[model samples]
Target: MPGKPVNTATKNERKLNFWERLYLPEVLKGLGWSIRKIWKEPSYTFQYPEEQWYPSDNYRGRPVLVQEEGKTRCVSCNLCARACPPMAISMESREIDGPKEREPVWFEIDMLRCIYCGFCEEVCPEEAIVMSKEYDLTFQDREEAIFGLDRLLVPKERLADRLAFLRKQQNPQFGSTWEYPRENNRHSLRDLTTDAESIQTEQ
Candidate 1:
């Protein structure tokens, strides 16, 4: 049988005092707090287009490919593309004659779809992709927002701070003391042969 309709409204609610019910005192108090903050606190506002704000190493702004020695560090592993939640990254890979035999023939990132979550940077095993300090992004249209290899690749020298920060974070205890050797990233017979020849010449 249905019991008497319960007084749900009165069950767990606190009764308002005279001042609270009046509401004017609470409103005045809030206004006073705001005014105090405005008068006492320093402004964080910047004059845009005139005074640009430079972000620090830890800032996650935009994902960019690392360009080392005139070529992209990415070996077309596609881990970043797969890890991207928005599916903003797309690429086509082709066989290449190099220490890293596979490279992206065409790589593009749709900035409009990219959420800037840093998933692409995090999943990249080669440390080929990393978050840069370029926060100011403006696009006239959808087509303009898509970034190609030309716009996406940043020289490793220019990204040294970010790379160092990443290394420190990845190896906190070591603090940039540990890094993968260049030789470890290559497995081609050509690279091995070159190394052996160089060793023989030195000896």
Candidate 2:
């Protein structure tokens, strides 16, 4: 059997007066405070459609693929698709005759399912995907919400700000000690050619 329940509030808590117990006075007090706040504080509401608001660099918005020259920067590593929590991203890859042999033949992202979490941007090793500052999205149908490669691809010049911000924020503490070489960006067997030649000379 349990001992008598303790009145934990007996000593610490103050008993409410008759008017306080009615609660009407407290409600009025809260209303008065709100009215005072409304009278004192200036409104921050935007005119919206007429006047657009641009977000800062750190703001996470819609994800877009980086287009370099006439081609995409993505090697179709599937890292972004795997990292997305909602599984909104999908792509089909194909082999191509280039240094970056693998490329996404078809890439699409369903904006309806996207949570704007930025996980896709975080996991892209090639810096192919990044969060843009475009927040105001309107769609009439589900089909329109699904963005294909044509809609997803943003020119590098247009995304320069976001790319620069990512580079600055993701820079390692060791500085440029381990900076990746541009030549290594290629995924071709030609990378091993130099090593093979050096080994042959040594042997």
Candidate 3:
């Protein structure tokens, strides 16, 4: 004996005829739609190199160290290197005679290893390293891809858009709770003049 049917169809399913089975009409319909789009729709593609595309402020292109007042804003804190997942950033810190007592003697980023994850940018307390808008990077060899301070440093004036975008993207609630004091990035707040005055009084 045959097994009983477990389920039955409520509505009758339509069977395809010879013409419908061939699928010529559906193929023609798709071809016609594509042709219409090709003629009517505006072309989005551009001839690169000759015609360069500008990225939006929100775009995360290459990462660059911010330069301010003809000097790198990086405090040599090494937070960015520690935060980098791919270990693309490396630097050597040296003592400097300035408000920021420490500075990176040589800073480098290996573009080959960098995943463009933006982790370095997020962890930087000084906001020294930020994602730039320059995405067109062509390297001939592996050695050439490693960017040093000369290539990595971008003037803060040129990065105004990215800076403003970052400020806008920051959560207001978080910003209020954790107040960012720029002076804190400096190694010391002790004034040299005040120290000298105190020394004179002691003498």
Candidate No. with top lDDT: 1
Lowest summed lDDT across 10 adjacent residues in model 1 is found at 171-180
- Model 3 C-alpha lDDT per residue in residues 1-203, reported as the tens digit of each score: 99978786557877778877889987898899999999999999989989999999988899999999999999998888988999999999999897999999999999999988999998887889999988888999999999999999999999999999998877566556556664444433355556667789999
Question: How displaced is residue 49 in candidate 2, in Å?
Answer: 1.4
User: Which residue pairs in candidate 3 collide?
Assistant: none
Worst 10 residues of 2 by lDDT: 182-191
Q: What is the Cα root-mean-square deviation between model 1 and the actual structure?
A: 7.5
Angstrom error of the Cα, residue 132, model 1: value is 0.5
Top model number, TM-score: 3
Q: What is the clash tally of candidate 1?
A: 0
Instruction: For candidate 2, report its TM-score.
Output: 0.67
Whole-structure CA lDDT of model 2:
0.90
Ranking by lDDT: 1, 2, 3
Measure candidate 2: CA RMSD: 5.6
